[model samples]
Target: MELRHIRYFLAVAREGNFTRAAARIGIGQPPLSQQIRDLENEIGTALFHRVPHGAELTEAGMAFLEVVAQFPDLAERAIRAAQRAGRGEVGSIRVGFTASAAFSPSVPRVFRDFRRSYPGVEMTLEEANSAQLVAGLRDERLDAVFLRQDTIAGDGIRLHVISSEPMVLVLPSGHPAAQREKVALSELRDEALILTPRAVGPTHYDKVVTACRDAGFEPQMGQIAPQLGSVINFVAAELGFSLVPKPMTQLQAKGVAYREIEGEVPIAQLSLAYRSNDISIALRNFVSRTLVAHRQPRIDE
Candidate 1:
């Protein structure tokens, strides 16, 4: 009739004695006998034969045992599933990233570590610019994102800055500035600077512009690239110089050389963005692992 009834029946069937079954299952002998009688009444069939020494199973009881024996295992499996899900170990998480953030070593490292640790969790990844990723997070289409945005906050979106690295210069291999190991932002005044659209990553775009102005120059604008990678490719084509995060130098795009800025420069930041109200266990686990892996402090407040 109930799980307790099943458990008592199993205990009596296994022990084969009323008193022993009662002791095994932590109930009184009289109470155990009455429980078995009640179970048989519910099923409208006698489940045990009361013998002189103990009790034996009837034909119906044997059949019932065969079916209910599996309940314990099944119940255990169900409990395990619930526990795993509660701990964020066995659900799906949709994650997004910016084009440049993907190039960061920390991004892949965090993903690898999370996958290894929570193999039961399903992960889906998307690549987009910072704005689109933020939109995805806000719209609940994405559980988390790695983006190069430091100013986006509020409106139920939270930001956790993972790492910040100095911005570098990417120049055509044949460009005059490429000859120097490091170039100052002010020196690129006359050279047209290739860039992605300001909307693609306003923080990064503004950082470059502000850094150049701080260096006493209004950077000349050249052909615009649609994305971060295209900005590097255009630099390879000698369209113009591009300023990018130092980590992006790992792209190793041919015909382009990466150089550090000599004087004051803006640092590009990579942040993990998520819905402030998201209660997904998998997403929480992912955010925790990411912050730990990057040794970043929690900035979600």
Candidate 2:
């Protein structure tokens, strides 16, 4: 009936004597005997044969023992499962990243650290533009996201800035500016500028535009690339020059060279985004782990 009944039954069956079982279970002998009798009545089966010196298993007792003997082990496993879930040690997390954020070493490092620390968690990764990644978070399709943005709008969305890097110029390998160790932004006033559209990443797009205007020129807009990687590809094809985060240099596409700006530089920021009210254990653990890996402060702190 009750769990106490199961314990009493197992103890008496193990000791093979009511007095000894009572001592083992730290209960009075009379109460133990009464509980055992109650159990037998409920099951309509005597579990032990009374003997002069000690109790022995009845035919029915043997059958019951086989079934209830597994309870202790099963109960232990169930408790462990519940504990792991409560600690956020098991479950799956869906993480989305913008194309540029994926190029940063910090993104992969966070994932690797999380996997090493919580091996039981399953991780799913998706790459998309900042707009789509934010949508995924709002739609509850993604638990968290890594993206490049200075600001995010709308309710129920939270952002944590991970790191910021200066933007660099992506130029054709044979271009004159590519040969220089540092290029001035004012010098490129007449060159066509390839850029990611504002709709894809407003913060990054605006930063580039403001930087150009501050340098005393309105940039000549040329071909537009939908993604950061495509910006490098366009530069490789000599379609136009573009500005990208310094980490983009790692792309190492042939026929493309990276040059630093000589004066005040535009910055690209990488941030983690999620629902403001998300209560998922996996998502909480992931956000904490990422902030720890990057040495960024947690939103709560």
The 0-to-1 C-alpha lDDT of every candidate, in the order given, reads 0.89, 0.90
Per-residue C-alpha lDDT of model 2 across residues 40-159, encoded as one tens digit per residue: 999998999989977899989999999999897788899999899988889999999987888799899899989998899999999999999988988899989999886799789989
Q: Mark the regions of model 2 whose C-alpha exceeds 4 Å error after superposition.
A: none
Evaluate candidate 2 by giving its C-alpha RMSD to the native, one decimal.
1.4
| Candidate 1, 34-140: lDDT as tens digits | 99999999999999999999999999999999999989879889999999999988989999998899989989998888999999999999999888888898788
Model 2 residue 179 CA deviation in Å:
1.3
Task: Tell me the lDDT of model 2 at 61.
Answer: 94
What are the C-alpha RMSDs, in order, of all predicted structures?
Answer: 1.8, 1.4
Which segments of candidate 1 are over 4 A away from where they belong? 298-301
